[model samples]
Target chain A: MKPSTVPASTPSLRQSSGRYLQTKWKGLIIAVPYLWLVLFFLIPFFIVIKISLAESIIASPPFSSLLNWTEDGALQLSLLFDNYAYLWEDELYYKTYLNSIKVAFICTLICLFIGYPMAYGIVRATPTQRNILLILVILPFWTSFLLRVYAWMGILADQGTLNNLLIWFGLIDEPIRMLYTPFAVYLGIIYSYLPFMILPLYANIEKLDMNLLEAAAALGAKPLITFLTVTLPMTLPGIIAGSLLVFIPATGEYVIPDLLGGGNSFMIGKLLYSEFNNNHDWPVAAAVAVALLILLVLPMMLYQNVQARQVGVKT
Target chain B: MIHKRSRWVIAMLCFGLAFLYVPIFLLILYSFNHSKLVPIWGGFSTRWYTVLFESPEVWEAVMLSLRIALINATFATLLGTLAALAMVRFGRFKGRTLFSGMISAPLVMPEVITGLSLLLLFITLADIIGWPGARGFTTITIAHITFSMAYVAVIIQSRLIGMDQSIEEAAQDLGAKPLRVLWDITLPILAPGMLAGWLLAFTLSLDDLVIASFVTGPGSNTLPILIFSRIKLGLKPDINALATLIILTVSIGVLLAAWLMWRQEKQRMQDRKMASRTDH
Candidate 1:
């Protein structure tokens, strides 16, 4: 009886245990990151929404709670729309939003013009040269981004290197006022974010099949026409990816505007920071964030969709 | 392979690279200037470096940033690796779309939004759970990990996709358990990608100013925050010295990484040649 029971139970026990362990391992893998993100990344948006609806108060937390228990034991919800209403009524907010979009768009276009050719050059280089070039492209990126932006301040200042060189060349009698101006802000954004544009474009352009171009050329299509028809269409995803990478963050760029734009350039990011830090208006800041998120959701979704497609293609 | 347009492309490349590097080289050049004024060139001196070294606040900020970066990198790499595995290896799990979206969203999310939301979460958690009672190191680290891990996940996920699955399958076919196969074959192969992800996370955490500013409490200034506040008033020579040091360290690290990757690729090519030779 003992021998018979052992023989039957052993196989079943092992099989069951193996299946159980597999499921448990898989569950743990999914659960840990999932729960962490849901807790920290996702739930906080809801909180922002809640706080955006609540009134700003002079308290430790600094915002009134959305929920309150009434004296009659009824659950009462209080959500003030004043923060949003205030944003809508104010001309400054809409103008800032539009200005931010315009800056981001123009910067993205400039980055594309600069980055595309660089990416093309890298892709056309010999393998050894390509590696070095790619590394060079990424090297500045590894350095502190803020420091890179700060580096521009040294170059673009009134008495900075560029101005000094110009004056010495007798090109100008006085130092050009480049820093703390809209020009400085544009220069900084392009300088800092050009790498972002180049990388994706490089990745896309590198994958381009040379045979297609050859075929197009062989068919009597001129080089420029072939490029427009074959190359550009194929690398549109990269263009979109790089453009979004630059545009989304550039729109909300706080550092560049604060440091270089001075009092002239008003980006949504700086406005949000001043609201939260300078005015201590949590509700207003949250409202600003929500509005910014609403504006950005489309591009963000487009980016995610492109990434997913790329992954899908790979798999 | 050369085209008539190659000349134009090459010129563009030169111009673009110059644009990127010229400002940085100028900053490095000016860091040694004796003048207190940033733009003026007094005779060269290393006084700024000495001043930077002597500043206790700078030291403290550096130490804190390093600590936060270290912790953030480790935890981020772990969680990110797990997320990558779950996404790439675990086939079509529940809420996979949502999971993928959450993983990628942080990559492009505005820092202000991410920072504000995370701070709000920490506050709510503190109110409800009474943990993380004050926002400082822990809150900053948590915020860094949340975003940095998204980056790590992208890196590791690409690694996972590019990896050869047959090796792991072979290990399983040879009677190795799944966990054992992962530990022995998968993780070793993935070490380089993991290292890259870790470094990226570390750099991101160290470089963050905006998010850290939002989450950081009193007496918790990271290096970027301190540097930012100083630079906000005006450019200081000491800060330039600090920037120069950061640039130097990053260049060295990047060069080392590139060299190692090159060597590894060479080794892989030689191994493949040998394998084909043996097969012949």
Candidate 2:
């Protein structure tokens, strides 16, 4: 549960050219990861910004050159706000984004609902029991995620397991349509991301330091009162972190919405795919991507602030 | 004694497990169904598995996915290990937090966004440089490596942060150069963490479908993509058979790991007991 040993390098380093060496090495250590970010993450984002300003093209890969202003004062390039206008005017992209966010939000709530009790139950169980429960939670993850989603499709289709069961039990006259519905999308998203929610909640709950709740109860607090006063506040950080992990990814999830929700899932991931692969509208896709970046910007900045605060570091 | 409320809690947990596992279990069970209808109970048969193996296209997609996963795992491990080492070994720089944040961003960013962004990059790159002529295996593998490396780095960095810095300092004091200190002191300590990170990255890449679908081009489909397209049309029982095989593999792997850890824990306890006896 805790690290058993601590390395003694600090004292020795402090004895020798310490501050200078530490400063230099720390700077160096941070650079390798920094460069990767600049190249793969940041640069790609900047490029998307640049391309979003351009006109759509029909090529193997779709992008156009930057529109530089003329030296004499008149604008030289054919750059315009067509893509942004299109996103506003066209009903589909905005609808997709809205739907994706809606699904992610609702799924996050269900995951929290299901996961909280399970997490609490495990933490209250014996350590052996907790370990077994945790494994059971993670075991499904070890299988191929796509294949598992595929399995869900087989189970949820009109003629699938639920329908078959209904007929066999004589509960229904005809099979109910399930697959390709928004309900199916919700099912897929919740099922897939539930583990992401549970693991963090479980980690925080298991380390809840039961003595606090026990002391509160001994002082005459009810079980519900103690949980509200003691347990809930302590696990706020983990809850936030877990939701970010689940909701962010679920927003942009492709396969689940694509398969279970079918073509009409109206998720942004499928829409982005359409712009690039089907619609051949690169500029529009890039612009939608810019919208995505803006959407992610606020929460991501919040996450950064939290990370900096974790080590008591100022940023 | 278990409380009344606790039983309800456990029952709730059991329902969650059913929600998670029943669909997959059903997938496995129905793999043996002799009929094409997924849920209809037919006489048990292994024909689907045989048919799955016989399909060359499926095999090729599986093989391609394997190759991509192996390559991605290798690159991710290397970059992640070095980045992790740097994060710990190097002193905190002006933008240390920023760097860490950037590297770890992929872990939380939606694979959809990551894929979308990367695909846009590939297209933009092609327009600018005319290299990587087409977005296919190479591009997809590169994309996987980029994200997987971040995960590996995070895991390895956590391990390095836990490690005692004194061991590496001791090596340095004993006439070892910086590189030699790293090679001897740091690497041995980091090996287990890196290996664990590598396996984790491998599994993640193998499990990816959303991102792969975004970045993958025509005629270069990965197994997950292939399976997904088929499932979209409708799930075949053979898909069930495939899921069963994968489940078996992971179950066996986890069981073996648990056994090994148990043995090591027992040995560690015994070793401590002997050491205490010697002191006495």
Candidate 3:
């Protein structure tokens, strides 16, 4: 009966219809998101590139159109290279870019040193303690970022909590001027982005094979040697992931530099904001955005590659 | 060596936790200070809270933010779910790499760049299409949706990847249509993830200051924009009050989520135990 049923059922007819329905459903599902991204996310970048090449005009929208009609009914393209040239010629922009990179690099290093120990501790903790500890780590992240920066302002102000505490301890004769310095900027960045470093490292460290460390120890390796030779190399991906997570965002950080670093610190984010808002130079702002994107493209691609590879390994 | 390293790890952990939390506690404490100056400790009072409540602009901004967040969450979740399905279920479609790149790029993109590029896009669109008349509620909501959906897609994609597919395959084997199987079996399983994605999208939209700042026109200030503009001059007691309130709300929400997850884990354990006992 089963053998007779197979031929009677017409398997090709069922399969073809099912496949046809699936193709339609698949197309619809893919098209909606793909088109939305193209229209909003992808195409806007091209517009930025176009505007960066156009002259800044004193009009609504604030940039000259890229294309114009000539007298003889010919389309003319008017592109200005001055914006990029201006960014090149201005030493301020160059210095600001360098300074931002330096700040981000230093902060990333600090975060790694601080966050690694914490992540290792969490991984070694009991299950119940691990959950609670992780929640504590992530709690600040759930709150408002701006408010956290504001909290630091109160702490680091001239007459603020930290200064008052120090004076009570007789550690200082006068209230130290700490707010709005590069010091404040570094502290603010490290405080806010510490979680980004810790979470990735924790995930990576948690997945480490304990047997490898055991084997290293059995081979007459000391605890420190086992850690250095086995644990550290195993968590290299995590270290890279965490560093990139902190460094990439820190390079273009606007809020921390603006609120904490004040006028003393000049990051690319602040430069772009001022160029667009205060100076109203749309073309220059677009140029700054383009330059920032170019600088970030390498790291961004690295991060994406790491993430894709991780997902691939998992699947 | 292990024993010594454990002590150091504990100390580091304590220090890191304190660093993360002390500022928040201090900020909460200062909200009650009566003095206008933020650092000074006057007698504790609710004056700042009263001031925050009295400001009409603050009310307007809060209302506008809630509206955008609500609209943005719904649309972002819808689009994000579709994208996740396309990514995980569809498998190896045309332009798949570009699609995935767009989905993940926004997670790490700088706010200033995103804001500037999106505002330019809007201006160009207004000139060419003239549909979105002005850059206000609609524009800000769209901008929020674009980035927020990226986050939602990541959340749902992970959930989709971890899901057991045998149940879905079994449903299809029992003469269920593809869409029928999706509606009846797949979506119910994905409901929790979708809810999480929605809440995250809402929070992101509500918290955004930079992107909203770029796209906002006259008479369309969001809560973050209002808070930012006010605090840019100096720290305000009323904003401290606002911050305390935000922190309280977020804490309660996070704690509730954590508790729920804990309870769910315990229940799973007990069920497993019961099943084992019965089998014995």
Candidate 4:
């Protein structure tokens, strides 16, 4: 998006009287969000880093002091690398990290598969139909995300709707154990995030110039081939945006796995929760959060770099 | 023929939409099931709805969630609009890139990390300053505003970028001050976007569970927390009833908003047509 920084105000008016007032308003406007982010967003991350370097202790607040005042009025400070070391030493942390990534990847792929066609169809729809279809896609999204995950419990449980239907049809001798499985976790993730995928994709696809596809068709290209060559390349940005939207949150997804995944499946979000709430290891939990943030941030920064390069090329 | 491929795409779309809605439909359907055991076809009954209404805890949680959502949405919209204005109106401020990154980061930042870091911040603040005394509604609302503002910022930013600057310039040329132009011309034009951002933030805060879980104090459970805690035991009919009611409320709200937007769009189109006729 292009930035419209220079407001097109009248120069004569600005020179006469509004110059001082303009700068003052601008200062106030900038200060509000700037100060809010610094105090709430930036300061919290610094605290996270500080806590991650502190020792774990069994106490009221559960983490050891980063700074200690000695009995003789001297000050002592401690920062432990032990929490970071434990992350490397333990195999489970890596596995949890990999598992989270793997699930996130699979969920992103599933969302893309399901979301692309919905977006495509909505774009192809007549104008009124397009609005209705888009609304349908977003309707479930506005409902509670937690409740949607809970809804899957009613559908995928052993005696739930799907299993009951399967058993009634004699397709299975017993109710299939579908709930509390990785399959259900994937289902829950896809169901909850489908709108996130579709909305972005729709925004891109709806604006597609149909004349390009028609020209391809006129050049004796098959519909499938035309879509593959012409449509897919144009919507690649949408695909990436949607995938990132799904993939990022899915990586640290606690609710779906916590509610749906069985004992065998573990996620970093769950691990972080247990470390803090269950084991009272605040510093370790902080370390895990720091690690997860690192895992998420590197790829995000790389994506931003690639996007900036693409925009540069375009310009 | 291309017709066959289009048919397949249409089928896929139908199946995809069905997959999306069927689970919600079942939840709504089974809400009326009289049986205590979920998913069983007990004849239709309103027992669960009545039970849900009778529960004080649910009411308390609902009220708390609404209040947080209200406050969070309002503050997020105000701050977010200001941030968007800063990015779009003020050209090259120091830390521009950092400001933009900070604004967008929370949109994709994992809730676990945000919740944990914010919790630690609150605790540290309380320890050092002895203010905020405890983590409760105020803390949760603050946390919600911190993240939800990112979403609001993106919305208003895009809206402001798309808006025509000539109108505001016209107002300024008429000797109106900068703030007056903003109030009389810019904000009125951005009203729809601001409202949309506000509603989006409200829903997001209401739906949040993880961050609230981290920040909540004693007796401060939000509805999502209440419902999630109960899920471990087993599915309850009352929870289903609660979900159904929530879904109903949301659907109605969404439909109303859509209708209003559609009407506003029509009005804009007519206004443009009338302007063109007079020009001719």
Report the error of model 2 at residue B107, Å: 1.4
lDDT of 1 at A95: 92
Candidate 2 residue A236 C-alpha distance from true site, Å = 1.5
lDDT of 3 by residue, B1-280 (tens): 8889999999999999999999999998999999989989998999999999999999999999999999999999999998988877765678999999898889888999999999989888888999678778999999999999999999898787767676777888898888888888889989989998998899899989899999988889999999888888777999989999999999999899889989988999999999999999
Candidate 2 lDDT (Cα, whole model)? 0.78
**Interface RMSD, one decimal, each candidate:** 3.5, 3.6, 3.0, 3.0
Better of 1 and 2 by TM-score: 1
The CA lDDT at B94 in model 2 is 69
Ranking by lDDT: 1, 3, 4, 2
Query: Which run of 10 residues does model 3 chain B get worst, by summed lDDT?
Result: B160-169
Write model 3 residue lDDT over A1-315, tens digit each, in one string.
124544443343233322323656888888998899999899999999999999998999888888999999999999999999999999999899999999999999999999999999999999999999999998887788888998999999998999999999999989999999999999999999999999999988998888988898889999988988889988888898899999998998999899988888899999999899999999999999999999999999998787765554444
**Model-by-model DockQ, in order:** 0.56, 0.55, 0.61, 0.62
Give the alpha carbon lDDT tens digit for every residue of A276-315 in model 4.
8898899899999999988889767755654443333222
Q: What does candidate 2's lDDT look like per residue over B106-141, in tens digits?
A: 877767668878877776677689867877789888
lDDT of 1 by residue, B1-280 (tens): 3455999999999999999999898889889999999889999999999999999999999999999999999999999999988877766679998898898889989999999998888878889899888889999999999999999999998887777666776777789887887789889988999999999999999999999999999999999999999888667888899999999998999999899999989999999999999998
By DockQ, who's the top model here? Answer: 4
DockQ-based CAPRI category assigned to the predicted complex of candidate 1: medium
- Angstrom error of the Cα, residue A23, model 4: value is 1.6
